[model samples]
Target: MKDEKIVGSFQLMKSLNKSLILNTIRTHGSISRSDIAKETKLTPPTVTNIVNELLEEGLVKEWQTGSSSGGRKPILLKINSSNFYVFGIDISPREIRFAITDLNAQTLLYKTITMKEEMTSSRLFQMIAKQLYIMMDEACIELKKFVGIGIGIHGRIDADEGSSGFAPQLQHRNVPLKKELEKEFRLPVKIENDVRAMAIGENWFGSGVGISNLVCIKISHGVGAGFILNKKLFHGTNGLAGEIGHMFIESSGLKCSCGNDGCLEALVGSEGIKQRTLNKISLGYKTKLIERTNGMIENVNGQLIYEAALEGDLLAKDILEETGRYLGIAIMNIIHLFNPERIIIGGGLAKAKNFILTPIQEVVEQRALTEQAKKTEIVLSKLGDQATVIGAVALVLNEMFSVQYESVS
Candidate 1:
């Protein structure tokens, strides 16, 4: 009976504390103890207890007193913005994206370091560490003030073991990334698939804000999808849910690096698109893309193709449309299977929204089931390239809040 009583009281405390903290400022805006009690249905004593704890934890701050209501003025309480920061990194093949963010995940500083030449997992990790150190130093932020560190990678992840289970791009499998980073910096580290991180971040701060069911498809050097189902990041069994890139979109077509043929990535990835376009133009294809690119057909990406289309380059425009149509085919399948409420397009290639989105939208509008299609809204990701890094930070915050609950309750 004694143990049960203690457990019941602890459970009550958890529910009440979370509600009071979230509701206090929510109802009254900038509220004080007296107002919080009046608005929350919580006793003045209980409100007082929780507010004091929040103040000490730097979660809330007391501002100046409000105007007198012909009685003793109440002290104003506001959410503290600078209490702690979540550091995030997106370790992409082309670049290293990093950000310093406050408690609410608002970025304070953003920086990118390029990987001009070769990229090895070990070397890239060190580069990331170096860039993070520089970012912290430049921002004059002490390591202690950082809530946590999060790194988003492109490929499968073993979330439980905190390792990169198998990343063809990174050429590392089951690498103990989180543990090694945590040991090096003395900070808790979270590692996740880049698309998964983006989905979480988008749900928290971008296109999926307030939406529970959505998909964020990133089209870059590679293509990937991140899903949010039942208001949570859904990584299926064995952490291999969002490998949309490797799925067979072409039965016996272009070979993918994953020992597969006709993966969606092979048909639309930057390298693939560039190779195909360069080959066509070099063979005397008549398109404004060549002249715009100064006739240099070394390597073209979706962005360049989009630029040409926007500039009325006929071949470039057609290429983008074709890719978008293929995307439509793949995304149509995604819609049919998962039936998401929203489809958010993002990535380096999404910058070519003018060229890619319209064709994809057209196909979806034409082919999808009328009822499901009507329910789903397709749009561009507001965070764009920053989505990956911001999502990484969201991973850290999720871990931080969960740990806080563990400690408090």
Candidate 2:
């Protein structure tokens, strides 16, 4: 027992030292073993040993020599961004988007395909494989350089098993997405909730770069949130930590996909906005939407409503203003609960821009605690349509570079 404990301790210490050394090299960019030792506070021998291991693994490479300081010039080290590539895929209810990116999350190829009237798990996986093949062919890169494929699905994901238990948007249950992809592509796979993936992407490559505590709210077919707390994605005990869409917003609101009434999703999601617009029209509200859709109310969607508002349609503008207010209330609730450093609004509705963000900001400022509101910067996602796909890539990169050490592969 004593020997086992000692062995475990030694392994833990070695992993921690390796992580520290790697992080120092990544952050400092062209760094030497002595510089890594100084930044990580690890002994020079430890830094050198770990760096040699990383070099052998091809994760780090020696760069040009640094300036001499009255002695021999030191060799600099940097992360080998081209050593491996990650494929990111975003599966949504209406469309499938995928991209190929380097270890640095720089997108090389991106494509979007609209979903047919109905989709099954088999069809979905086949579509993903087809696009991946096309992307790889276009890039003409060696397959051996591929590290893994990351998938972001619009639903609850079993991270450990890489399966989805329930995806209301997909109307599918218990799909073995990860296993299927790994079998088809013959590569390792990482799967995560779409919004959560976006949050990871933001933290690693986008706006949340230096910020530790942040929230990413996605509003589209449904509402969901992803959190980065204390420099880590906070997955609650049940991995449902960021399901803010179901937060109670109205006591008498319409029914939500989760079978809840008055949930925030029921009030501000894409369907919710469409339902509200239909109700207003039914109640004889005046607007150019009727003429815009040629009197086909069923044809109205969040995008059409936004377009109508842009065209100076009164009802459409009112609908969006109300949607923004509800969204603001949601943001206020997020502020009071998490007190995050930044709140990012994403998804299809994000395109509403000032039409939606303005109202959300106004509500948050007026309703949330002054201190929390002041500290939290609410802004639209900088990634736009690429957020989820980039986030998928981030999932692989994040796991690869995470300092937690225990989960590092």
Candidate 3:
């Protein structure tokens, strides 16, 4: 027992030290071994040993020489970002996106495929596996060079179990995403709620970079949010911490998919916008939406409404402004609760920023409790359409670089 305990302690300490040195090199972009030792507060010998191991593993490489004060120039080190790869997958209600990225999260290849209606769990697995093989063949990188796979999927996720507890869009429950993907690909897999993954992506590589407290809101088929508190993703007790879409806003508003009345999602989701536009059209409001949709009321959609709004259609403008105001209310609630450093808006509705951003800013400016709170930065996602997919890549990178504790067996 004593021998086992000593071995476990050594392993844990060694892992932690390695992570420190690796992260130092990653953050600096190019750093010398001595600098890494200084940054990580590890001994030079320890840094040298770990860095040698990383170089042997193809995780890092020594780069050009650095300027020196008097003695010989020191060799700089950097992540061997291109030597290893990760697969990022985003599964939405309408489509699935696949991307291959390097250690630095730079995308090398990407593809999107439309989702078949009424997809079952088995079908989902097969489709993803097929796409993975296709992308692998296209990249022509050896299988050993690919590190892992990451997935950003909608609905309630049991991240610990690597399964979707319930996916409202697919109407599927308890799908073992990690197990099946790992088995098929013979690689590690990480899965998280799509919105949460978006938040991670933004934090790592987009607008939220360097911002410790941030929130990412996705407004498309539905409204969802991901929270980053104290520089870490905060998953509530049941992994449902950021489900702000169902927050009650109006007592007698439209019915939500969750069987709730006047939820934020029902008020501002894409479906909500479409429904509101239809109601206005039914009330005989004058608008170019009718012309844009070519007299097909069923064809009236968010994009069409945005086009009409751009053409100076008052009714379309009013609907989008109303949507913005509703979103602002929810955002205000978020500000009061989480007080994030910034809030980033992504997904389809974000494309309508010109029409809706003002109303949202107006609401926040008028209602926030303090001057700083009112001035809290709000911006569109820098990652845009690729936010979630890139976030999936971040999942794998985070696990690879962060410290972890494991039981010795």
Candidate 4:
């Protein structure tokens, strides 16, 4: 028991040290061993030994030497961002988006394969595997350097088992996604809620990199949030913590995809925006949208509405204002609950930046609790469409490095 405890302690310490050294190199771009030791507060010998191990593993490479003050130039070390690759797949309703990313979560190659709406999860996963292999072949990335596969799916997932629990958009139940993929590819698999995976990505490499507490709210066909609390992805009990889309917004509103009445998604999602515009058209409201969509109500979508708004159409702007107001209510609730330092808005709706952001901020400033509202900064996501896919890559890297979750300041 004494020997076992000592061994475990040693292993933990070694892992922590390795993470520190690698992270230092990653953040500094190229750093000397002495600088790494100073940044990580590890001894020079410890840094050298760990860096040597990383060098042997091909995770780190020696770059050009740094000039010394009065002695021999010191060799600089950097993370070989290209040495290893992680494959990420985003499984949405009508498409499977695949990306091969380097260690830094930068996309090396990206491809999307559209799928039939009626396909089964098994069939989808099979296609996913095929597309990944094709991408790997095209990129000339060997399987040996592939870290693992990270999958982001639309609905609630049993992240531990890599199985779906409830995926209304997917129309699948209890699919053993991780098991099937792992079996087929013979590589480890990590599955996460698509938005949560995006949050993880932001935490690692995007806008939330240094920011500790933030929420990435996605508004598209559905509404959801991925939280980075205290610099770690917060998967609440059952991994459903961030389903803000389903939050009760209206007691008697439209039925959501989740079968909930008056959910946030039902009010502000892509379909919801279209429906609201149609409602206005039905009420005989005059707008340029009639000309914009050629008098076809069915043609009015979120993008058209934003375009109309940008063209100075009052009705379209009003609809967006209403959408932003609803989103603001939800964000106020988010502020009251999480009190995050930053709230990142993404998804299809986020494209209408000023149209949505201004109203949401207006409502938040007026309605949210004074203290929380004052502390929070609402912003749009920088990752854009690549958020979830790159986030999936981040999942693999975080796992391999065993990222240390630091407390938010």
lDDT of 2 by residue, 1-409 (tens): 1123222111232465676776677777788878777877888887888888888777789987746777767789998877768899998877889898887888888888898744567777787888888889998866666777888888743334344434342323324666676676666677778998998877777767777788999999878998888777876765667788888998756997667798888989888998999999999999888887888988899888999999989999999999999888888888888889998889999999899988888888787778657557888888989999999898776655557311111
Report the lDDT tens digits of candidate 4 across residue range 1-409. 1123222111332477888787778778899999988887889899989888889878889987646687777789988888888899887776778999988887899988887663555776677878888898999987767777888887743334344335432323324667677677666677777898888787787777778888999899878998888778887665567778888887645887667789898889888888878888899999999998887878888888889899999999999999998999999999999889989998889899989999999988888778657547998888888888988888777766664552121
Compared with the true structure, what per-residue lDDT tens digits does model 1 show for residues 150-207? 8887774334435543444232431556645666676767777888889888877788
For all predicted structures, in order, the TM-scores are: 0.81, 0.86, 0.90, 0.88
lDDT of each: 0.73, 0.78, 0.81, 0.79
Q: Per-residue lDDT for 100-133 in model 3, tens only?
A: 9998889999999996673667778888888888
Ranking by lDDT: 3, 4, 2, 1
Badly placed stretches (over 4 Å) of model 3 are 1-14, 156-175, 403-409
Model 4 residue runs over 4 Å out of place are 1-16, 38-43, 156-175, 406-409
TM-score comparison, 1 vs 4, better candidate: 4
Backbone Cα, N, C clashes tallied per candidate: 0, 0, 0, 0
Which candidate ranks first by lDDT, i.e. highest? 3
lDDT of 4: 0.79
Which 10-residue window in model 1 sums to the lowest lDDT? Answer: 1-10
- Candidate 1, residue 44: how far the Cα is off, in Å: 6.2
TM-score of 2: 0.86
Assess the local accuracy of residue 90 in candidate 3 as a C-alpha lDDT between 0 and 100: 92
When 2 and 4 are scored with TM-score, the better candidate is 4
